[model samples]
Target chain A: MSEFQNPKARKRGLVIQEMPGEMLVYDTETNKAHCLNDSAAFVWASCDGVNTISDIVREFEANSKGTVTEDFVWLAIDQLSSKGLLEAKVEPKFKGKSRRDVLKTIGLVSVAALPIIASLAAPQSALAATSCNCSSNSDCALQAGMCTTQMCDNRGMTPSFTCVA
Target chain B: MTSLQYGQNFISFGVAIRFESTNARLLQKAVKTANKALIGNLKPTQKPPEHTFVFGRNKELGTFVEHNGSIVAENEIERGVFKYFDSYLRVRIGEYCPDRVFVHSGAVGINGKALLIPGNSFSGKSTLVLELVKLGAEYFSDEFAILDKHGRVHPYARPINMRTTDGKYRPYTVDVSDKADLKKRKPLPVGAVLFTSYKANAPFRPKRLSPAEGIMTIAPYTLPILVNPAYSIQVLHEVMNGALIVKSKRTHAPRFGEKLLQYLAKVM
Candidate 1:
């Protein structure tokens, strides 16, 4: 296993919406919205550049009323880094370990096995917003430092083909 | 800022437009059509509106503008006027409503709370909502669910926007007060969230969703989440408390509506 280090959340252009047990994070920089479950949210919020892997696992155990292993924190950190939610990339400690080895090593419940982050690309406005029904690609909004490819593809529904990107 | 007054007032989404113009007949037609398209047949009150804006027609240019008191559009007055009106009403509601999070979803009252169905265009939201309404559920809205900070839902009543078989869109309004079949209801807390759509030959199979899953499913349809992410997240989170969320695929609405309500009653 690699040495553990504190992680930090990215600070710019990030909007977070919290539900009862999950967080919806909209990263304007990437033009993507991510849904982090309670476990993942807790891990992300706890990343203060101070909490080590062992510290996070203890915090999870205290609040979740369940046991967790350091591997769980590592799994979450892996996802956060991949999604650009972290300030820096985190190297997975179990790089050489297979899925079976990791599961056996952690010995956590199914729910605590790992964190899951679901995401989707959302338009700047509603699908029915006038901007979405653009006349051409020039009219489509720019995202991630690039112009979104816009085309008409509604199969002649009503006003013919409505623009989509 | 030119100010003209003719003592005519029209209100929608708590925003008022005091009509002021020499073209009184045209002003009346514009108000009526705009009200029909944006708001239901709500009674105009003597109490002052929350926000007031002046509306006037430019007889010379054959155009009109409200709120900003500028020539926002010129020519094609009929279409331009209502389009601008719709946009203004939407913005006004979002700005004025402090506690409500405006979500782009169809909602109906079931079990003294709301059943919100979230989806975008071509997702069969309207068709499913119509079915729920036909099955004796109180209609909240076909387009938006005005969810309060406490998570209760208020009515944003408007005509149902339905597409005909030929793919032509049309608005159909239901007179709840007069309709004997439809039940009358007030704003209620959210009891359930259904993430569903019509699928050909897809059996009425439903999978329950966690609160996290529910938030993600509805996130795309919640308008306020996009506008004020931090505040919206908290509001929607609280709004979802004690609500049953289901992700389901069904072959039909009328048949599935019965089963769905039964499921909600048992769970909620």
Candidate 2:
């Protein structure tokens, strides 16, 4: 792990919307949207560039979030770092351990829900979701009037156009 | 090539556009088509157009439609020209509309609250919306759920396009305004957002989604998401704030619609 004990959340190039118990973070840089559950949101909010992992554990417990260990906090940091939500990437503390194994260890002791971040890549172009009645690449080229290479996706019950790089 | 002779400017949802044509007859047809596409949202505007569309016929390209001086669609048949223009105009307005967020959704008002089913074309949203309307729900739209800044849903009640089940998926339009009393439709507070698609023999078991998760689920169907991400996310956040979001797979629209209304009544 890096020597920097205080982890900061990345605020640049991100649009955040806080909900009842969850938070939606859109990374404009990567065009990815992440839904951070309550536990993860708490940990992310606590990462103010001054709180160490141990400090976050105490804060998480004091907030009536159930007793959590450093391992639990590390788990959230690992995910946040990997998703580019953290300002500085932190090396995985559980280096060689499988995620299932790590979660199993964390799940046994923690009473609160484990921190989870669900993510999805936003569409490259909004038109991809629109209906296009085309059966071939040439048809999409003519219909959409774009010069880029595109293919007709017929796997679904209906056909649509998907841009190909 | 025939020089464009007639042109008209229209403003809809805060976006201004101009349509021109070489033939006067075709220009009127284009105006009529644009009005239908926006469900009468277009209004005459003297302001300069932000985007200009030209429809004309020539020996080289035959019948063609051009947007911003680029040929978007060209065909030998004039009928294809209007069809292409209708689709193109809807997408362009949806992308650039400054005051509203257009989601590819089917919306219906039930008990004065709106239920939005967000999906793309051929996702069976139109079919489900038709079934709901038949069950006495007020129809809002089958193509778009126009959302205001406060996340209230306004009616975009165009004619529902139903796909024929003859394996060709040809669509036929159905106007439910007479039966649904769409003239009385008003903006409604969103009560629920259902994300589901038709699957063969699939049972309707719904999974509740968190607000953030709900935004992610509907992001792809949001028209201005790429054009204005901040505004789109803000509006979507308002939508998810007070609405129930669920995902499920269903077998048929009629049966599923009945069950869904019942389930919503008990839960919502």
Candidate 3:
């Protein structure tokens, strides 16, 4: 929306380094590295700057087989962008490779907001993987990577996480 | 397996695990510090029944743990569930067991590869790593897993070059035999690295550690300089050696073994 990007900015602004058991983001401005452990890595990768924050939230829904709200994505993104790691790029020009992904007709798809899933049940080694049966955002009480064996959703979501009986 | 009240401060709820293959110097050092520093801090409580715990089923280990309320084991693999509660930490062992790393404290999990188990105790490191082999993780070594200057995981030993569960400690096992023991000696390359923290809510999260962060995490673990200062320098260089590093949360066991196996198969 705003033409604030510098034309001569180098690509030296962001660096992603994968080390033993960790993911790190190096910010040029602060000369500091922000680390993302295992679960965070999954979120960081799908937080594509090209997509609106809502689009990225949907990506996690698809990945976790769960749904979450637009606000969650915005909350996550705003925090990341505030660190100067994310930069807005001008929309790419129409190119031949882009055509392969889809028909170019402009259209609209219904976007549903899903709540975080927080299961408290302890994980069992033999439980069957349930299909994404969630219908709304309220179904997910657990956010992403919860420790303690299972999810911790007390209300507003079905119990999925395993806990000590 | 007798209780000699070693410390006034360190109160152990659930079970207190002791290493049978005793390296007295290290044990005494750890215990003595607890005795001196834990006077006002130690508090004993009823074992939380919900704090479900497990240990090697060997009759010998069971007897020892029963008498001592602590299992003294190392060099042998005990694939079972167990939990330990302390004031500062609650260890869940044997969930998704971590892979072994060759460092000053003994074997530990590699940083960022696919193994899911992380635990305390240097001796258990290699035994748990052996278990990682069962989950389809590439076998490294049982002892002295090393970090190269380029940040790659190298083998410090082949099989676990540590002590074994011999003598009176033999009954607590599904397989009570001399051959099933995890003995010391050998090295291999590490594909992943992990930094482990002990907390209850901690689940298996395989993460990628940044190079500088890797150096920081490896610092405390690599402290007291196991070999020469050069070895630590070598470890520092090796931490940056290009393998993956991760931070893990563990309690009691090779926690998160099955789930980790499931997750790693897709990632690595």
Candidate 4:
């Protein structure tokens, strides 16, 4: 990662919803959903394959979001890149440093809120959350090899479902 | 191949389905079972069914249920066949329904607004919903919260299948149809969404979720999310915009339901 290098946000295969002080981005390719707070959303919006790290910091200040250090902008970039929101993957700048140390250093001098993105993977099959009764391995709700069911045995009573590896 | 002796076409949530059976008696039983599976969600349709389910008996397979030519469930007991088909049909409809999104949630209405508690089976949602109904909140559903394109919740008021306190935790249905004013039931605007699971003796300290965070939390339980990501996200945005979303760990249903109503009465 370089301060002079320009970054672009990935726009393809994503569904985004902009809400008050937050943005929701769903990656259709990976089935991952990310919730970006205002600070991170601003940084992502500014990444148009044109703005350098220094330029993003200046834009942040111009928008009256308060003064932010270049390190703070890097923190958001590292997260966005790792989450596959960037057009090109950037090597993590804080690879060897603990997140708490980085946050502490950024929080000490930056007046703006710390950038945070919360993410969750949408299940490939919603049936994974619900119960399923299967007569064969193929009918199991979960991914292959993780779930296998026993032969259906009711014997004139309620059905019993058994899972075996 | 066994000749299909009886069949019926039905529409549920805009998804057309046909149920066929080699035995006339089994077909009649299946019709009754399908009605219970969706509650008031199903109706007869003239359109060709997009999915077809067949029920039949054979010497080798005994009794079986098939969907689109694949065997879904097989058992010697007739009761088990219908039980498995009931669950299968619900999941199928939830997965492919074109017009509505089905979330595995328990919904109730208070002051004409719906409160949705989203969770999978055995999460104690049914117990909480029953308690809420006992406390005079109008019961919407104990299984699913069917959301239309506008994000309004329509009632899927089926009998609450409450798990027994015995060690087995077997489910038993408690019919509240007498209490559910189905004649007057209509779609209710979402007032709030609560994400909670039973944790014995855990204090009910709910933290508010941002709209974006709320959508992320509910995405896994949303059935059509993977099928139609754009439409699902659009509807979820509509839901979180006007609704209060919160998450917490709850204690027993009776005690927590009482406290929850008080908390909602103040906040919502």
TM-scores vs. true structure, each candidate: 0.70, 0.86, 0.30, 0.87
Q: Global CA lDDT of candidate 1, please?
A: 0.65
Q: Over 4 Å off in model 3, which ranges?
A: A1-165, B1-102, B105-127, B147-189, B198-201, B223-235, B251-255
| Candidate 2, pairs of clashing residues | none
* Candidate 3 local lDDT, A1-165, one digit each (tens): 232221111235544555544455544344344555443454456644345545565676777634555444443343344444455433333334343232222112223322111111111211101112223323322322211222221111134322110
* Model 3: per-residue Cα lDDT at residue B237: 45
- lDDT per residue, candidate 2, B225-261, as tens digits? 8788899899999999899999999888889999999
Best model per TM-score: 4
Worst 10 residues of 3 chain B by lDDT: B79-88
lDDT of 4 by residue, A1-165 (tens): 543268899999999999989899999999899999999999999999989999999999999998999999999999999999999998888899999999999999999999999999976666555543444434533422223222333221123232221
Candidate 3 per-residue lDDT, tens place, B1-268, comes to 3323332122332233332212334334444333322222224444322222122234333311121343322112221111111111111211111222234323333333423222233324544555555554554434233444343444322334222345212111122112322233223344455566556656776677555566444533342122223344344545455445666665433555565555545654
* Model 4 per-residue lDDT tens digits across residues B86-157: 776787898798878888899999998999999876578999999999999998899889899899998888
Give the per-residue lDDT of model 1 (tens digit) for B173-253: 444423332335456888888888788778767788777566666766766555566666677777666787888887777
On the 0 to 100 scale, the lDDT of residue A148 in model 4 is 22
**Chain B TM (all candidates):** 0.73, 0.95, 0.40, 0.94
lDDT of 3 at A121: 17
lDDT of 1 by residue, A1-165 (tens): 322478887777887766766777877666577889888899998888888888888888888636777777887887788899988877766777786777666665434635779877644554343233444434433321211232332221223223332
